[model samples]
Target: MEGLDPRAFVLGCSAIGAGLAMIAGIGPGIGQGFAAGKGAEAVGRQPEARGTITSTMLLGCAVAESTGIYGLVVAMILLFANPLVGKIAG
Candidate 1:
């Protein structure tokens, strides 16, 4: 039997890794959107609380953004440093 080409196998692994990495974005996107809506509603209900609401909302957004950042890091690793490629090569 013939063996698989290293380059083709590596490219396929990279594609799968990229797809898996992007899946992480789902959490942050939904969480941030929900936070934004809640912030808008909070400001609507109590205009005087705008300062506090905005601060809290921003903090929530920052936390939520971490997931997206993690996803980006994974994607970068998959595209650039693909550890699986090393294992396959070895």
Candidate 2:
């Protein structure tokens, strides 16, 4: 590690972190898909309640999406704000 260039190492780690962070998207995708399925089923069983079911499903999807959004923020920070690089220089 001592032989490695600091900027290169930081960038490499940032790439890895960005990749890992993107994995967070999987949870929201799965949750939203499941919610959509359940919503469809509920709507099928009670056509009159479609409005309520759809709204509830949308809310759940939004809540689930927060995790993915956080992951995106982390990735962006790692890529752009990379405090590690500055600390290494100082």
Candidate 3:
């Protein structure tokens, strides 16, 4: 780290932070998968309410996916439009 310039260090850390941000995606992935499985199970038990169950499951999945989208946005900003590099370096 001593040999690295401030810009390089900031950029490297920003990249790592971006990578860490993407870890938030795992939660939504797992939540959606669980919701899908439960939806399937519910449908199997109540075939008559398939439409209702499907809609609810989709809504839940959409809500769950928002966190992943936020993570992606944060990662993208860090990777492509990092303001910290300039602030810390300049």
Tens digits of per-residue lDDT for model 2 on 1-90? Answer: 668888888889888998899999999999999999999999999999988999999999999999999999999999888877777764
Candidate 2 or 1, higher lDDT: 2
The regions of model 2 sitting more than 4 angstroms off are: 1-3
Could you tell me which residue pairs clash in candidate 2? none
Worst 10-residue stretch by lDDT in candidate 2?
A: 81-90
Q: Each candidate's lDDT (Cα)?
A: 0.90, 0.91, 0.95
Better of 1 and 2 by TM-score: 2
The residue ranges of model 1 lying beyond 4 angstroms of the native Cα positions read: 1-3
Q: Residue 26 in model 3: shift from native, Å?
A: 1.3
> TM-score winner among the candidates?
2
Model 1 lowest lDDT segment of ten: 81-90
Question: Residue 50, candidate 1: how far off, in angstroms?
Answer: 1.1
TM-score of each: 0.86, 0.91, 0.89
- Residues 1-90 of candidate 1: C-alpha lDDT, one tens digit per residue: 269798777878798989899999999999999999999999999999999999999999999999899999999988888777767645
The candidate with the higher TM-score, 2 or 3, is 2
The deviation in Å at residue 22 for candidate 1 is 0.6
